[model samples]
Target: MLELQCAVRRDMLGLADGDSSAYVVPDSLPPRARLGIYRNTATGALLTALRLSYPAIRSLVGPEFFVGAARRFIEHCPPPSAWLDAYGATFPDFLARMPESASLAYLPDAARFEWAVNVVLHAPDAKPLDLGRLAELEPAELGHIRFAPHPAVQLIQSAFPVDAIWRAVLTRDDSALAAINLAEGPVWLCVRRTTSAVAIDRLAEGQWHFTAALLAGCPLHAALDQATDAAAHVWLATLLASGYFTEANLEGQVSNLPSGDPAT
Candidate 1:
């Protein structure tokens, strides 16, 4: 039974030629024809999943082009699990390698931005941080505080103006799309789910680094050290207010800061 299932899946994904002998079918319905129906249905479902996850890509390339690209991607990388939400995670990399997409230099980044948005939207919910807890900590203890990043948060850095491209394409704002300057330097983005919807915000390089460090479970002082900009404290306050973290913990016994501590 396991072998039969594997054979059916391979056939459906076009990974192998149809093996009619593997299945029992009525005389009126050829076994190969029955397999074709299953294959088509499976392909359509996968295509729908990709379209939903990458609407910006579809809009940017048009339906026909998007279909061809998605089909090729599906053929190369079939879904690894039954959960479709996690599918297409590597599609951005695939697009980056596709010869046809080579002309659209920013397409891969745009797809990556979209995937981040998709991931945030589908991530498990996390409790918002209780801001009142911060006031209880002594000043000396602040440096040892470790913030737990919200599960729904995702960070992306792109050389292209992917944020602008995604916004314009998804919203169908032709003028905004045309106004985009591809050479407008790189962008660091924070993608997370808010109370209402997914929010995508561009952050300065310093803030991006600081937030990334915090998200990686670094202590506040350590993360602050990475914030080259003078506004590190301000950025921390803003992130706290935005519910970027779920909890904060002092790394060790709260005591006087060590002489080597960045805070000192």
Candidate 2:
């Protein structure tokens, strides 16, 4: 019975992709519909998960194409975990491989940006770093410091204006999408949750360098050195105002930070 249950779990999850013709008539269901139930349920769950993760993409592709591509994608890459949130990690790659249009090359990057936004919305929350404590740190000790950004913060860089694309679809103004030139390439963006709303900020060239540096665990001075001179202060102010970036020391101590664990 234990082995039968394990086989049922594996086959239903599509782990038995190679061949399971021999087991299709197992006594799980009436012989007439033995494996049909598993097939329907598994496919339905996969489609639902793909839709949840890529609603914008689904909208872009219309229901028919979206369903077709989703079915194909699921066959190649089954969900990795039982957790729904963990599904759809490979969707962007699957889209990028489609030989549709050179001009539509940006679609996959847009999908990736959307996925990152979803992660930011669901990430755990942490209190902002204490400005006073940071001010007292000696310059030499800065390198040893490792600060944690808000778990709800996500940074994404794309070779397309994915930020603009995301906004066009989500905004009320339908004409906003008409203004987009697919020829335009590249955008760096930050997605973070603040005041109970998830917002996406498109970063300028200089801002991208600065934020990327900070995210890479660089020290303040080092990150500043890497930033465009004019953007240094602006980036610092933005980071602080966003309420991201918790000091490494205060991480485990939930008492030190506000809203230690965030909602999914």
Candidate 3:
């Protein structure tokens, strides 16, 4: 029974030949024909999840091409989790490794952006840090301050113009998309969400690193040390105003919700 089950599973994933000799057919039906239906259905379901999760990729490649790529990806990277939303953790890497899209180099980064968007959307809610209270802290005590990034704060950086491409595809702005030069830039973006909607914006180098350090559990002053050419106080005020930090330095400890897997 175990051997038969293994064979069935392999056949279902198109890893083995679904020969008639391997199985008893009902009503003398053709084994290959029967197996083909199940195989196609399973592949289709997985493909649908990829298509939904990475709409920017689908739109850029076109449905036919994206489906072909997704099928190949699904064959190797089956979901480890039963939750479809939680699957495809490795899809951006899969796209990056594909030789066919070597010319469209930004494709991988665009996939990363879309994935980050989904993650931000699903992240749990947290109350904003009380800025008024923060202003009351003594300068000496503030130096050791550690900050918590909201659960939805996601940091994403790409060597290509991923942010522009993702935005164009999502908004269906064909002209904007056409005007995008993939070689124009390496973008650093912060993607965050609130009850109303998700927002994606480019960040300065210092800002990006500062947020990254904070999210990685660095203390406030230590994270500030990672910044470049910026007044830590003013910039930090902007980050707080933008709703990045949730809470800061409680009982001499600063803590925040996990900001999903880091996007590079």
Candidate 4:
């Protein structure tokens, strides 16, 4: 049964030619023709999943071009799991490598940004850090603290203004899209789910580095060292207030921080 399933999957994904002998055919329809129906349906569903996850990419490239590119991607890289929402995580990298997308240098980054939003939208929920407990720690203990970022938090760095491009494209603001300066340096963005909606906010380079280090499990002092600017503490405070982290640890011990007002 497992072998048959594997064979069917390979056939559906275009990884192998259909073996009509393996399928029970209707009297009127050829086995290969019946199999093609299933294959086409599966392909269409996968394409829809990609379109849902990458609406900006679709808008940027138009329906025809996006479909062509997406079909090629689906043929080469089928989803790894049953969860379609988790599919296409590597699509941004795929776009970067596609020869047809070479003219749109920011296309990959825009796809990446959209993927991050998709990830956060589907991420598991968790309680935000307790500000009251964090405030109780001694000043000396601050340097030894490490934080666990919320499950929905995602940090992205892009060479082009992908956020701006994503916004313009999705909103269909042609003037905003046209005014985008591709050479506008790099952008660091934080994509997180709020209580009611998803948010995409830009971060300063220093803040980006500091938050990245913390997300990587660095202790407070170590993360501060990675900050390129003098406002490391300010950045940390702002992030904490925004509910970026769920827990904080001091040294090797998990701090028993009670759930308090995150805004505090």
Candidate 5:
């Protein structure tokens, strides 16, 4: 049974090896016809999920073009796991390699932005920081502070105004899409899930660097300097409002970061 299932999957994905005759075929359908049906159905299902995962890509390339390229992309980079939401993480980079995408350089970044949105939507819910607890800390304790990034947080920086392009696609506003200049950025963005839904926000240069450093395990004091170098820092009250950092640690541990951590 296992071998037959493997054979069916191999044939469906067009990755069958030689000795196709070795697998026993059902009497009702010819082998080639059955294989073709399986292949179409499997690829069609993948294409639908990919389109849903990347609506911006579909909008930019149109239905026919997106489907053709996505079919080819799936052939080259099939999903590594059955979890579809986590799939296609590498698709934006795959788009960058396509000759058709050369003329539309922002397409890859826009795909990445869309992918980030999808990821955040499926991320585990996270508690926000308790500003009251943070405010009580002595000034000297700031140096030892470690911030815990929310699981839903994702940071992105792009050479093009992909954020604008993504927003236009979401709204289906053709005029807005047309007005977005490919060279308008270097845009910095952060994706985070709110209690009700996911949200993306443009970030200042300093804010991005600061968050990036914290997200990478940099301590509060040094992250402050890093953020202040590129942008201004107003400190914890303002930081908590962004919903990026979920907890503040002073002595190497979370005191308590409940899902319902009270807001100030």
Candidate 6:
């Protein structure tokens, strides 16, 4: 009987949406009263997590809309894990399909940008390559080198100038009125937590290409060759100064590259 009661409560809390009539243990009011409590608790926890994940989206749509959308979201896609961070992975897509809110074309992209920011904040940081280590590598040796960026580094490209939209919303003042053509080209964004704070920077076309190439594991020389501007070293220096790349693995059988430790 206790096992049966546990199952009923689990269903009530949405752990499993089973047949209500079949499972209704019509014994006493107190018997299933606890089940209702569990259900409310489960729903409340999910609502809070969703609100935290998409505060900007909440602000954009207002509280009533956010809660309504969240209820629908919980019903369709119950979180598969207890980890709150992993709970809202489907939220951006959910926003895209919200019937009443579908008019806001930019909403999905803005939510996606916010998700990227959240991802970056949790990623690990690392030290960038030093100049001396880079100088020691032979021309042929540049090909096999590998690099690892700080775990927090993320590249977000969106049709909307989402970074601008995000900034406007965050600043709470729409005073800086820059006309953004929603259909205009996508903005390539670099999101990372550097020395000061979590930052979002808009990448120029050339810089975007350069970063993309590097991210794709291209060797330094090849990445530079493919870059439009061709001033690869300058770009590399700029990024290094900005504390982007943390680990530089040189090519060839050499056990180690020169320590570019900014600490030294």
Q: Which of the numbered candidates is closest to the native, going by highest lDDT?
A: 4
Candidate 4 lowest-lDDT run of ten: 255-264
- Give me the displacement of residue 201 in model 3, in angstroms: 1.1
Candidate 5 lDDT, tens digit per residue, 32-113? 7656776788888888889889998898898998988898888988777778778788999999999987988788888998
Residue 31 in model 5: lDDT: 65
Q: 131-187 in candidate 4: lDDT tens per residue?
A: 778778889988888888898999999999999998899899999999999998999
lDDT of 6 by residue, 42-154 (tens): 88999999888888888778999999999999988888767877678788999899888879989998999998888776666555556567667687876667665657788
CA lDDT of each prediction against the hidden true structure: 0.87, 0.72, 0.78, 0.88, 0.78, 0.75
* Model 5 spans > 4 angstroms off: 1-5, 17-21, 132-139, 229-232, 249-264
Deviation in Å, model 1, residue 252 alpha carbon: 7.6
Model 2, 139: alpha-carbon shift in Å? Answer: 4.5
Listed per model in order, the count of residue pairs whose N, CA or C atoms clash below 3 Å is 0, 2, 0, 0, 0, 2
Candidate 5 similarity to native, TM-score: 0.85
Which model, 1 or 3, shows the larger TM-score?
Answer: 1
- Among these predicted structures, which one has the highest TM-score? 4
Q: Which parts of model 2 have CA positions greater than 4 angstroms off?
A: 17-32, 100-103, 249-264
Ranking by lDDT: 4, 1, 5, 3, 6, 2
Q: Which of the predicted structures, 4 or 5, would earn the higher lDDT when compared with the native?
A: 4
Off by over 4 Å in 6: 1-15, 18-32, 129-132, 177-185, 250-264
- The full ranking of all candidates by TM-score, starting with the best, is 4, 1, 5, 2, 3, 6
Candidate 5 clashing pairs, residues 3+ apart or interchain: none
TM for every model, in the order presented, reads 0.89, 0.82, 0.80, 0.91, 0.85, 0.79
